[model samples]
Target: MSQQLIQGNEACARGALAAGCTFFAGYPISPSSEIAELLARELPPRGSVFIQMEDEIASMGAVLGASLGGRRAMTATSGPGFTLMQEHLGYASLAEIPCVVVDVMRGGPSTGLPTSPAQGDVMQARWGSHGDRATIALAPGNVQEVYSLTIEAFRLAETLRTPVAVLYDEVIGHMREGVVLHEPTPEELGRRTAPRAAFSPTFLPYEPDENGVAMLPDFGRGYRFHVTGLMHDERGYPTSDHVKVAELLERLERKVEPAVAAVPPERYRLEDASVVLVAYGIVARTARAAVDLLRREGIRAGLLRTRLLWPLPAPALTEVSSSAELVVVAEMNRGQWALEVERLAGGKTVLAPYLKAGGSVITAEELAGHVRRLAREGVAVS
Candidate 1:
């Protein structure tokens, strides 16, 4: 465990290598191109494979192919590119393929800011694929967390056999800082227990257990099976029947959700403050600094930095929401996570957003100013 200064995006690339990633395929895009560049140079020489795909769509399809080939694979992209990959993300979900996706989110609807930072994809990462599936999006505020969280992303993807999103804003992605890369203990490493039939001459391609997770045969393992963008049965065969579709989709979602509570949650300055603040991604880092700034100025405030964005950290939220004088939710989007909190909220908690879609980073000073105003108005922090 040694400390080295690295950009957040580059840290993610190295983290991928450490997490046993053997394949990299992506179309280069702004703010995230460093990752592609780093992987391209490093992976091939190390016996891993890297390819720059023609586009984001093919980039994702290639990920599926690689993962099925028994490689821990990944892809990196910003907003526009992520949008193009959404269709295939849904396919990975329906087919229950395992892969990690690093979405260093930038501003967006179209060609929003190419180089600027924004948390606009918070909601998209979870609900983007045109269905009710929940996504595991890990938002990191700093470069160090970017590397550590990415390794966890890969483990979670393999654990539940779902595509996990390592979501970060451009601030974290572009910022340079010392990252102490992890050296996971043998016990901590979560290697996929590849089926023994892998060495057998013949095997069931989609053989599943009681957990509904099937043992996938990697592409070159001589285990041939069909995969598709359409809903598939456990056998990976296409199905048009409504019952089969519903069953497959439900299993796909539950294979993750039932135990999502075990996912890590980061609780910051929110221990005793009546008015709690909540934010994620790079925005959460700003929110924390604002918390400290407001405290020194005599505003009793705290923060709940959301690391696990998908499960919403419901119990922890309800606990804080019940006691706070008011709570403020901020993000790059228009109250998406705030809406989730509002539903679970148990008090007179108020929602305030220093929200913006202009493809810029929300500064600690900007958030502090809002806290000062709230403190002055006595508007309530519960």
Candidate 2:
């Protein structure tokens, strides 16, 4: 293990390298440019490929191409660039091309904030692209988690045969922290499942194994197959068959279900508490601190910091919130994820939101005060 003080963006870049990523394609964007910058400096020296594409769309295309060619590929961008890559992201989902995308979230609908931090991209990461597809998104609250989760993103992408997203706010992306970087063991560095039999005309490239994941072959491995954005059959050819299309979508979502358990939420002080706070990314750091402050005030407040953003972690969330009288979903956005919590929450618990958008972070003092007032009044605080 090696300890060093490094920026979260730099940690993400290093994590990519540690995950055996050999190709990177991205356009420089604020809050996320450091990732591309660091990879450009480090990748070539390590005999890996790094390219600055003309735009986010092209960058995603290049990454898909590289991944198909049997390379661990990735890209990094902020909100605006991430929007442009949505089309390609959808394609990757349907085609089952394993890749990683790092979104160092700023604020946005359209370039809302360049340098400031925000958690507005939570919903976008899961639903920005068209169609009904499953998404695997990881949120890291600190620099150390940024490094570790970046590697986990690649591991999930490879093993599940899908694109994985690593999301963190600008605060975590640029914040400096002392991180103990550990090299992943062989088991930690998962491999993409390959076809068991020799490729031939009868081979179905999209045929799923017992795990519901398709064994996709590398492009130049003499396994000729189609790769398209349209719904595909077992042979990887375009298909409009209603049964096959429905099955494809169902299988796509079912295969990624393992991620819910793979990346569980961090339950803090929730053992016996009446008030529960929920948060993720940089906001989770503040929420954790707020729990301590509330506890000191005899508020019996606890926290549920989620690292896995997608697939909802419904079971864990339901179990935790069920025991609490109040569940406060705090975030640095206009209640994006709070909506999900509301949906999953039982009727017994009162759900409140602590939302602050426009690039400002939710402070511990602010969150603790809200919880304190809510506890006294026995009502939801906006």
Best by TM-score: 2
lDDT of 2 at 248: 95
lDDT of 1 by residue, 1-382 (tens): 6789999999999888888889999998988999999999999999999999999999999998888777888999988888888888888876767888888887777887788887888778877888877567778778988887788788878867778888888888889999998876543446554555654434554556566666665566556677776766656677798997887767666677633465555677666786678888778887888888888876677888777887567777887777777787878865678778888884446656567668777778988887678767878642
In lDDT terms, which candidate is top? 2
Cα lDDT for residue 22, model 2?
96
Per-candidate TM-scores read 0.91, 0.98
Tens-digit lDDT string for candidate 2 (90-114) = 9999999999999999988797889
lDDT value, residue 294 of candidate 2: 84
lDDT of 1 at 322: 79
Q: After superposition, how far is residue 79 of candidate 2 from its true place, in Å?
A: 0.5
Cα RMSD of all models vs. native, in order, equals 2.6, 1.5
Give Cα-based local distance difference scores for all models.
0.78, 0.91
Where model 1 places Cα greater than 4 Å from the true spot, the runs are 193-212, 220-224, 258-262, 346-348
- After the best TM-score superposition of candidate 2, give how far the Cα of residue 178 lies from its true spot, in angstroms: 0.4
